[model samples]
Target: MKIKLLFFFIVTLISLSANAQTEVADQPAGLEGLISSRTAQRKNPDAKMDGYHILIIFDENRSKAEAIRNKFIAEFSNKYDADVIWDEPNFKVYVGVFKTKLEAQELLNLVKDNYPTAILVKDKLKFPKI
Candidate 1:
């Protein structure tokens, strides 16, 4: 009876250890498969630009332009999430690539209020290679 009890205890410990090992081994494979699937989805180039693009112009002088750029960044950073591009002759600040012209117009209105000098220009605005 003593030998039987010892064997039973050893068998139970071994089964528990095996179960724990299986669980540990399965977790990483599951995570890796998920990661690989997500990577594959991102690798597909079916993504298209279905959004609106706006062009903005700001004065590009040494003192005034710097101040305007700083002010625009501080003010619209959270509001419109603008992407500012500084050209040599002028400081051009472009806002979001909105999904609709109305969205761009809304941002233009806001910009007009903040920077009254700002103008809504054509989307064909170009920036020199930086």
Candidate 2:
């Protein structure tokens, strides 16, 4: 019985040791560049990404822009994120953070009749909410 238990313990230890070994694969050539780029991006929290947004209102009056933004928010509910940005003389109402123009165009098509002047504008956009 003592010999049998010792044999079982030895076999278990050998199996565990064998299973502990890990195989390493060669990293891709571009992996270092990608890692460095990601590290740089992480270091800059305010770094903006180039993307598209649907421009709903571009008016010189702040009140009018706010009114339009309110109307859009009421209509769309919580379906999108809307913002009223002041750019010098004009206050702009931009909607959605889209990675591609096609995505912005899709929303624009749905919004076109309500806002005839709505158009896709290429700009620095916020990251989409998780």
Candidate 3:
């Protein structure tokens, strides 16, 4: 049938192309080179680690979220950084990167006065600052 002939032709072309390949390495440059280099560097050490944090505020409004983040930054006596995360229905204001729930709770206790509903939330934690 004509269908059988077409299938044979396709297989023949694929086999021909497959056999005509070389083992030449790619010369990635610019952005690709930068990405490859960074990934290679990460292989030796952790670029970041998964951890926990304390949620200072969860607000649907962007302005409220910014206000909470700014308030914590101004009043917090610790070295932890506060960041606003946008997740679906709300913006979360998270402060500090703790390796354990206990560590997060310690921070939560300190922030309870300012953020009454503050609680520990597990999330990705960045490497400790040098």
Best by lDDT: 2
Q: What is the C-alpha lDDT of each candidate?
A: 0.62, 0.88, 0.83
lDDT of 3 by residue, 16-129 (tens): 999985889776568787988877755645666778888888989999999988878888654788889999899998899877788888888888987799988876566766
Tens digits of per-residue lDDT for model 1 on 1-130? 9999999999999999887744433465579889987677556555333455455555565566556556777876655545556677776666655656787778778777666656554453222222
Backbone clashes under 3 angstroms, per model: 1, 0, 0
Instruction: Write candidate 2's Cα lDDT for 11-93 as tens digits.
Output: 99999999985988889999999999987875676767889999997999999999999899899996888899999989999
Q: lDDT value for candidate 3?
A: 0.83
Q: Which stretches of candidate 1 lie over 4 Å from their true place?
A: 1-56, 121-130
CA displacement after TM-score superposition, residue 4 of candidate 2 (Å): 29
TM-score of 1: 0.43
Model 2 CA deviation exceeding 4 Å by range: 1-23, 39-44
